[model samples]
Target: MCSSCVMLFNEKNGSILPEYTDLPTLQKGEILVKNKYTTLCGSDLHTFTGRRKEPSPIVLGHEIVGEILELAQNEPFYDLNGNILKAGDLITWTIFAATESDEFVKDKMPQKSASLFKYGHVQFTEKEKFNGGLGTHCVLKRGTGILKVPLSVDEKFAPIINCAGATAMAAHRLIDEIENKNVLILGAGVLGLIASAIAKQKKAATVTILDIDDTRLENSKSFGADNVYNSLNPIEELTAITSKFYKKGFDIVIDMSGSVEAIKTGLKFSATGAQHIWIGAVTPTENIEINPEVMIRKLLSIKGMHNYNYEDFINAVNFFEDHFTDYPFGTFIEKEFPLQETEKAFQYAIKHKPYRVLITI
Candidate 1:
């Protein structure tokens, strides 16, 4: 089969070079997928701009949706839902693949297992050049968690299910309960918006969102945000708004911005016993100081979620399938570029900083 892919040879140079490679033969327990669409994510942008470091000669897109092209012969492959996988079934898999015996799997963080293989983050080799989503084909490793996407789910909406959508699910999973809770989301990007919607669906008393971008704040309202505030406002003004609107502060605080300043501000508005989940700090950043006394008195609990586990991915798919029509998910994609223009797509994503940009493969 013919295959083409864009590779990032050097993050310092910030170039995505196109290359054509011969498709590799399927190995035991492996599955091949023809990537249909991939969305450029914030992490992808970081790698492109050299803010995050990844090995050279890697294919970098990961928010992907594709159809199964083939499965290793002489064995039956089943998805997370126990359905048999076959060619042409639209699907999305966990960003990571880890064997059952992986040490982290026993710790309940399969995504962090010792033998983990992340889809878009690995360096390409002759044996597995199509492992990332930027390519025409992706080889789903043996331990990857696969799920079938409902045909009703729009192609564009399915791509983010594995990344932004799944991470949002994982964030909520960490928080545990949302009913009647005043939920605050920090950031108005794709993850923030999805978290807001999920909180609303869980019957959150109010969904408040904060972002520097007014346009994104305006968009959050459509995604179930009850209060939208520009974080650029003076701290005193923001404190006043939070005091008046949420007298006891927010019951659950979620940070999707990864801004140290934002996390510090969110701490100010968290109520006693509030649960705080941080999902956006994938890259290293300057540490923020915290007052141990204040945290102790408030009985606050803070948790951080990186990628996501298999269960989170399944919940993400189910959430989108059940509510795809409930929100304007399709509108989240700001632009689309063909696979050949993958470089241009990254450039547009960097320049515009839209919620998402898609590469139609």
Candidate 2:
């Protein structure tokens, strides 16, 4: 594991340059995975733009699917039986930090964070704790494996399930609890499109998508949006549009773009006893005032969904496999670039005009 590894780093702001790096030595009970495909998450944008920072000279990327390249011996990676573990099996994880104790997994929240933060490179040495999917391979320490990706699924799409797809699936799962729900989602990005697909698959009475661009709205329809509206005024546009489709306000509202004004106005269009799920990770400094009385009077329910759990990941994968066309065909769009082009990939992902921009290393 001491051999040189290649990774992207932010030595300067707003740019990423590939640097030859040393592969991290395996810790006890840890396994080194040669990352195959990693997706640049929206959170990676925050870090790139200096909106967020970890320890300097760190690798960036979290959502990844990889193959185990090597395993620690002496204390073999398998169970009591001497099973020889080999590489090439596709796997996906929540990418949590490795913990020596079992107590972390016992606590749900800690376990979740640990799973998501495994690629953190707190220090820039061979102990690359902040390392993530932007490299040739990533180290997945023990106690963090979520599920192995089935060989039947496309490896390219695996990363999406962990982040964007999970957000969509989580929102849909929450709405599935209600009866004959009508979903109105803002923003026709990949998350919004995936959410609309799931909502329709769950037999939502109506799934209406709102976005300013007619192209995105058309894409939303292809992803099972029952109707599409190109409008900026959420309250007026949603009320009018949804009324024409369901003759009532939307039974649920999902804000994927994290616009405060959009959220506030969308709140008014939610039907009585409706559920509103917030999946977008808005900046912490942004603040919005909501009328508690209006929420109470309307019997509205609002929930916040972060990263999806193991079950949600499985659901998204299954959804893609079973209903690929029903969902947006180009959800995983753009192109695949080798590891060296990571900086270019990040810029392309942040720009508009595609459902998802993926890079394969």
User: Which candidate's TM-score is highest?
Assistant: 1
Compared with the true structure, model 2 gives a TM-score of 0.86
Q: Candidate 2, which ten residues in sequence have the lowest lDDT sum? A: 76-85
How much is 281 displaced in model 2, in angstroms? 3.1
TM-scores for the candidates:
0.96, 0.86
Query: How many clashes (backbone N, Cα, C below 3 Å) per candidate?
Result: 0, 10
Model 2 over residues 1-361: C-alpha lDDT tens digits?
1233555565476567766765667777767787778877767777777777666677777778878887776665541122344566667666454353545445533335543444643435655642578777777666554566655557787787667876688677776464467778988887888887777777787788877888788767778888877775444655567666553777789989777766765686777777888877556657767789988988988898766654566677667767765544544666677777877776776675455557677
**Model 2 lDDT, residue 158, Cα:** 75
Cα-lDDT of candidate 2? 0.69
Off by over 4 Å in 2: 1-4, 74-86, 97-107, 110-116, 120-123, 176-179, 233-236, 245-247, 329-331, 351-353
Runs in model 1 deviating more than 4 A are: 1-9, 244-247
After the best TM-score superposition of candidate 1, give how far the Cα of residue 311 lies from its true spot, in angstroms. 0.7
With a 3 Å backbone cut-off (N, CA, C), the pairs that clash in candidate 2 are 5-21, 95-115, 96-114, 96-115, 97-114, 119-130, 120-129, 120-130, 121-129, 121-130
